[model samples]
Target: MMIQRYNVDQQGVGQFDGGKITEQKPIGFPGEGSEVKRVGPLFYWAWAKAEHEGYIPLHPHQGFEIITYVISGKAEHGDSLGTRSIVGPGGLQVMQTGSGVSHEEGFVGSDMQGFQIWFEPHLREALRRKPTYQQFEHEEFHQIDFHDGVHVKEILGDDSPVALETDVHMWDIHINHPFIYHQQIGKGRSVSILVLEGRGRINETSYEAKEFFVIEANELEEMNIQAEAETRLIVIEVPTTVNYPLYRK
Candidate 1:
């Protein structure tokens, strides 16, 4: 088991939306200048910040499940499925581009921050289903408040609105003060953490804003995460038994 950690500077950064949107892409598409991709069905993990309102024109995607979580502002979404809506802070938007889909997205405020994660399903099985979309608000999910100044928000889990056909658990944790939180992963499950704001120490290693830490399945154990200050982070735990064929440059 191995734990891999990456700071924001170690990840690939790019500017889009006419340079208004500066993105730190942990994984990106071909020809996009990002090289970080996962194996065994998980393709991309990205955290983006939009300093100003802007749009990414209609683009086509297929054979992937895209999950969007808005952290600060609102994002207007429109897709070929005739879905048009706004996902605000603590809101989630998911699009399963089984066969294929075209969509457009735009930030809605002076500062919009969010995460866009790409998860892959069995390609053969996915192509047999039509594209679909699911939306969920913060209230629709379960929130567990710990006595140690830590709050865990389950975004995609057994009690969440956005259900996936895959075996994955996604959570958002916000620490209002100095505290530690522990999460136990199953034997065959891998865990990944992305820090959104503030600072923290994970496994004796201190991490600041926009850092990502990945723990292999064999390394699954209780993680000691202590917030140096008010901190917010996202965690993804998934099965490591499956192999995902990724597309890269």
Candidate 2:
């Protein structure tokens, strides 16, 4: 299997919320000063941090499933749909902009940290549907405690509050002790590993914080993750086929 690593510093950087929010974007669009967009079917992966309470103005999106996971502090979300809510640490917000939608965001407290991930579906089918939103607290998720030092938390899975029209599986893993985790990717499936904290080895390559490793289905077998510290990571598994055509404006 081929393993590619992307360090945190290699990601594109942007400041928002009057410079209160600093973002590190992986898989950003090419060229300078351009809004980061998806390559292939994946839209974007952004890690944002707020120095203090702040807000991002209204913005429009379509034909994509947007997911936000809070790591720390609180995040307040409001949209044109008249939905307003606050998501604190370990909370999740999923917005499936099947056709189109507009939304705004704000941060609370001295430090706010979170991740915003975008996934795309078949464009033609997506535009035919209406947008929807779903929210889940950390307590609603499935948490597996391996008292032996391994824990697996299902953030989005087969039996989760967040649902997607496409075939995708996402999880957050926390390991406090030494252990090996395995995942089998079927044929034509793609797997991406993003390390949020600590260090780990994937296929013999060491990956540190903010590093992403994308493994192609045809190039690999199962995946093995080993932690060198109390590690936290987000994994996304999806099919390799281009089931959707992205619309860029």
Candidate 3:
């Protein structure tokens, strides 16, 4: 078993609207100074926060699966595909830019926070399809609670409402007490974990708020996440290797 950790400062930074919005990127683009540029198919992951509000004008994207997960407040998404929607807390907005698409987004409410993640698919196959957009409301996802003060909300998986061509699974987890959470990791796979709130330890390694860790496929069968306090987190599980050629930056 092997593990690597990155603190908030170790990640890249970006801002918009005169710094009204700031971002901590764990898997950013080249020259972005992020520790992990691309974890298999996972390309970019940005944890963005809005002090009062912020906006990003229409931008073009191609052959990338972009997702925005709302954490605290709401986000307004407007795209050229005639898709206009507002996703609130626990909601998700996915944009599969096949051939191409132009879209703009903004954060609303005080202290609005969310994550913008990009996943790359097989470029040739993705570009052969049409551009699309999908939005899942806060009530659209399913949640499961265990006996242990732990809860797992399915964001993307076999049973999740959101579907994509990318082979990935995502979840939002929470635990309110000292507990050990275990799971069987797939062979030749990896999991990207981001500590959104509170503190915890993976095995014996301590991790706090806004930390990012990548657990790779290195003979680790089970992962034990031990929480010492009320902790909340997000996890993205993907293959350890991509079958297609990735973008070079």
Whole-model lDDT per candidate: 0.80, 0.78, 0.90
List candidate 1 segments past 4 Å from native. Answer: 30-35, 243-249
> What local lDDT score does residue 15 receive in model 3, on the 0 to 100 scale?
88
Per residue, candidate 3 scores C-alpha lDDT tens digits across 79-182 of 99988899899999999999999999999868999999999899899998899999898788889899878999989998799888889999999988999888
Instruction: Give the per-residue lDDT of model 1 (tens digit) for 65-143.
Output: 8998999888788999999989899999899998999999887666899888888777778878899988888788899
Query: Can you give the TM-score per candidate against the true fold?
Result: 0.92, 0.91, 0.97
Better candidate number, 2 or 3, judged by lDDT: 3
lDDT tens readout by residue for model 2, 57-176: 999988788888998998888898889988899999989988899999987767888888888788788889999888889999988887677778787768677778766788888888
In order of listing, the candidates' clash counts read 3, 0, 0
Q: Of the candidates numbered 1 and 3, which has the greater lDDT value?
A: 3
Q: Which pairs of residues collide in model 1?
A: 40-243, 40-244, 41-244
**What TM value does model 1 have?**
0.92
Q: Once superposed on the true structure, which residue ranges of model 2 sit more than 4 Å away at CA? A: 32-40, 247-249
Between which residue pairs do clashes occur in model 3? none
